[model samples]
Target: AQRHSGAAMAEQGRQRMADDRCNAGGTAEHARPGDPLRQHREEEVGRERGLHGALRLRRRVALLGHLGLQHVLRPPAAPLLGQGPAGARAEVPPHAGRAAGNYPMATMVYFQCVFAAITLILLAGSLLGRMNIRAWMIFVPLWLTFSYTIGAFSLWGGGFLFQWGVMDYSGGYVIHLSSGIAGFTAAYWVGPRSTKDRERFPPNNVLLMLAGAGILWMGWAGFNGGDPYAANLDSSIAVLNTNICAATSLLVWTSLDVIFFKKPSVIGAVQGMITGLVCITPGAGLVQGWAAIVMGILSGSIPWFTMMVVHKRSKLLQRVDDTLGVFHTHAVAGFLGGVTTGLFAEPTLCSMFVPVTNSRGAFYGGSGGMQLLKQVVGALFIVGWNVVVTSIICLV
Candidate 1:
């Protein structure tokens, strides 16, 4: 019992150290896995102190397309931002920002690849059994090269949108929104599954689906938490918000199912869980816990309305073969999250995680109104880009 007590005390010490590092904002001296400041400054000043730097550098340098020259700048290439002339590596000094080290160069490419693959998988969900394997095989490289890379660059990778101060804390636009829209677009191209199949596409295994959903819910912690690039208070809050929003969404969805259909549904609960996660992701660490609850409640009902009522009412929506309703779940919920983020993002929290100075949600009533506009415009840009790029890929 004494030994266990000592261990617990040690853990508390570590946590307090981490919190210190997080608040003071020092270099990533111990960032082996990119631990944010959690103690006194270490000797080596880490590259990309927080998410701002992480977004501008880590994912930017990492999300190289298969065949795009502009995205990937290899070693001898000139530094992107430095105290030197615009061109030529020899002209730039080594001590300039981002020129000192190849942080996140090869080591971080896998992270971008994983996200890109996730977007692809979500796109596939809408066409699930109907898409041709050969076509899908051909489609993956093209879409990744064209669609995914562009969005990553434009948003998180420090393109025009990032400069415009559009906040997508964890790929609300880049991954979820893009995939949802692309999935719907691709489904349109592929046409609906067989009438008989569409009419009765029962799950082959509910138990397996439940297990998969559970695994996904667990992983979502990393998905939102890792974005802060540290395990500091913001990261902790993000993880907590993820779980809170998901649980609230699941309950709300289940309650709605019971009220409308007179029974609880496992499927509805899963959908609720997903929407909740997607909804909070944009501002998971940026908003307060109370805001997370509000977002979850909206996520639960809005997507439900879109999927249950709107889908049923809209003939055009009916024409599209969105098998798993990825459009409603991801696209709608992602958009909701983005808008809510512009509305609820707290100033202090935003300062910790968001790179932009004086960034706050509309609820704070400063530049938040304009921030909301940016969110809407950002959504429109994503929607338009995916619709065009995915369609071109499908046709080709």
Candidate 2:
């Protein structure tokens, strides 16, 4: 009886030791192929070590790239105050006001490059799903040099429109209008996507698209806020107006969708958001908050009408096959913004934001009417130039 008892105790001890080993090895007898607890612990360890290391590496690489770009650009020093030829408060030198080793100039250059990049991305909307990669590579440089540079110079670089007091606070005409017209023209030349794509070019991932759109929306704060070239009251107003207009336009658009289509669409709301942002851009700092809401309403409704109603009716619009409706969202909204800027730009705000002295909207009752005329003329010039240049580029 004592020997049997001792044998039982030995067997029990062996079984407990085996169980301990299995647990420590993370391969318990009952463990499945993918043990949840073990897998989770492993993932946590990886995140702590691997993710932190990767993030550090990414930040270092970005910093190195930025330094290289700064070195290559060799931006000039900031202009000195009262250093003009005649001793008047000198115009800020194009590369003026370096806070640290020409950082100001580098920053300005970076901003301009980003603006140009955005323009290219907008133009790409037309060429998506088609266009030879080689041609696109060549086309970018040519378009920037000839088409984009000319617009930038003419409007913002003290060219004809700048001298004439036509205000584009943040590239309503230069970026949005230029890209829209250019995209439409390019689409005509490149031809449509395959019929299958056209018949059903559904977004592969709606959530991802929404995420992209959210980034774009938030980025507009920098887009408009930085135009003042300083962090001032105007910049603050511009950023606020941007959000207000975008939100209002989104709500208006969604409501319209629910009424007409019997359901709200995330895509439609995004489109409305874009239109509102575009519409307010030209006068972001130059218009009052109330004007922004009014502009939002117009932007949301007019673009919606054009995209949904006029697009179907107009043969030219139908033939172009602009995949993303850049024409309606950008061209129409931008034109509307320019016109409204001419009409609603407050005198005080204009004085603060516009380069031209005493600039005021038509509603302010001075040379305001002329401003409107100039705005229209400027739009026509951009449209004609983009159409001609884009066509030439495609043909070449």
Candidate 3:
């Protein structure tokens, strides 16, 4: 009786094992059709694919900001007025032509947007750590429409200055000069940061600041290069000149810091870099390599003196609290660039890049002296316009 019971128990155990195997095999075979886990995984995969597609679409839209849609959409023509001698229309080269479309109209819209955006960013420098959010929200749109547009039209859009033959290579007047003056004006109205914050303000992250500076430096390739409205030889030369000036400026500034402050501050280096970049922008392509180095050295030293030495001594500068010293970096550097461009702009390069026919620097003789006067006049107009407009905007 005991043996028979044991055999029955063993048979029952085998049957249970067989049932477990069958269930496992059945689940594997039917997983895709009915399993909840498998269905959830498929749904997850679909969501991921959709997310990737959306990211790709967003990337393409961002790229359009750099490559003007008008250029991509329409055929090219003389993109700006006064392209050649005596207002003669210059034919666009194929490569440069390929990048620009719809001539003055579409390209104008795109460039105006670019310049407007940059101006807003520069203006923000003065308002940092202070300024009411609501006021800024209102200020930007109004400033863009009223102030920036006026400058853009007057300078580049065949308005008074365009016809008058005022040359602004990549917005020395429209962007830097305007922003610097406007920023300083606005800061006066907005009031200064709290006393404690002003006295002890320190950068939150040096590494992050450096990273941002690096991006700014690299992006300049497009900043000055795109002003030509095409990918051309002038664009290439502008990019090279931009780097040359920036590097020279950085070295000069670092050297000054080491001599005076006894330490080479990274922040100081970045400031020097910016001043150098701003200094060369007015004639990035219209100046030779040697001219770029000269501009850089002056940009680095002059701004340093104004910011470090003059700022400390001047009561007005001390009282105003021009944060980041936009006045020194943008205003002073920009004006200096304009003056030097007048003095050093290579005649051959000027003819190629500037729309003003027979344009030459002061060094080249002829109407070169007149050109320098025009640069100063252009800067004055910008300064006056910005001061008035910015003050009104802030006051209101």
Candidate 4:
């Protein structure tokens, strides 16, 4: 029994010693602070800091990228208190002054580019059926920069002319007038189509022309509706007024064709419809539906007469040989529209849509002071710019 008791005490002592050794090793490692859990925690902390640093760096880079892009893409800001070279104020309007970097303005700018594109396409009609594709590629961008951009910037981009209060309404002076004049000018430079083509002048495919007409008719909804920058009642009014003018012009033109030629030609009717659309563009948002009808009758008849009778008689005009009849379609129609707007502008409607307090046009109980002056200035500015720029582009 005594031996057994002694052996048991020895065994207990050995077990306690082994436990002490293990405890000592644990204590030593913790005291040195080299435990795996502690190292893992440190590593985790380091990884978190590195991730945070990376995120901050990325944010800074993004900010710099945005600033650089803004500088490149946005128009330079003009001084607010200075007078421009020609006595125009160097101030941005309220619409243009709002965050210039906003997406809405960018979208509007892109829309304007589309408008410029379509105008060029219309001009291309004169050069069609014969123009080399390579020449057209060069002409499109050149004319856009030289002719379209200046007119757009000057009239709509808050440049010198707009500050002086020239109301183009929806581009009677800026788009149609400039495109017409520049198209005719370029056609003069490019010269007329082949004499054989001139003699056999019917379109190869009237169906295509009719299709283009349909697209144009539907697209005018966007054309005029987009001018107001919103899908509001004014857009509706403009659309309604546009259709009225087109319908009235069509009927008038058809009647004239039957009376003059003893047959109503679809081609002649198409010309009248186009003139009506172009002539009413400037006045669509401001004039009543009835006024549009009156404007249309005059536009259809006068421009048709000018193209059919007056152009054939004039030696100076024959020398130019404006292939697509741009003079009558864009210039004459646009000018007539501008003049008609000055004559038929309804006071209430103009006051509502135009953000100004000028009197109605000469016929609508408004003073002629700002009206006639504004129209004349707008037209002259567009015409003068086109003459200079079209000359430069063609010559260069």
List runs of model 4 lying over 4 Å from the truth. 1-106
Is 1 or 4 the stronger prediction by lDDT? Answer: 1
lDDT, candidates in the order shown: 0.83, 0.84, 0.81, 0.74
Of 1 and 3, the candidate ahead on lDDT is 1
Measured by TM-score, how close is model 3 to the native structure?
0.73
Q: What is the lDDT of residue 237 in candidate 2?
A: 78
lDDT string for model 1 (1-396, tens) is 999997886566556546556666543354443333321232122222332443445434544533455334664445577635443333323222112234465646776778888999998888888988999999999999888899988888889988888888888999999999999999999898889998898878889989999999999999998776544567777899999999999999999999999999999999999999999988898899999999999999999999999999999999999999999999999999999999999988877755578889999998999889999999999999999999998887
- Candidate 2 residues lying further than 4 Å off, grouped into runs, are 1-103
Ranking by TM-score: 2, 1, 3, 4
Q: Write the per-residue lDDT of candidate 4 for residues 125-216, one digit (tens) a residue.
A: 65666667887788788888868888887777787766665566678777788888887787778777778978788666888888888888
User: How should the candidates be ordered by lDDT, best one leading?
Assistant: 2, 1, 3, 4
Q: Which residue pairs show backbone clashes in model 2?
A: 78-96, 78-97, 79-96
User: Over the stretch 1-396, how does candidate 3's per-residue lDDT look in tens digits?
Assistant: 999997886566545534543555644344543344543443443354444455445445656656776446344565466445523433534234224544778776786687789888998898787887888899999999889889878887777876676777888888998898899998888888888988898888999999999999999878898787766667877899999999999999999999999999999999999999999998897888999999999999999999999989998887887777788999899989988988888777777655678888888899999988888888888888989998988877
Error of 1 at 107 (Å): 4.0
Model 3, 305: alpha-carbon shift in Å? 0.6
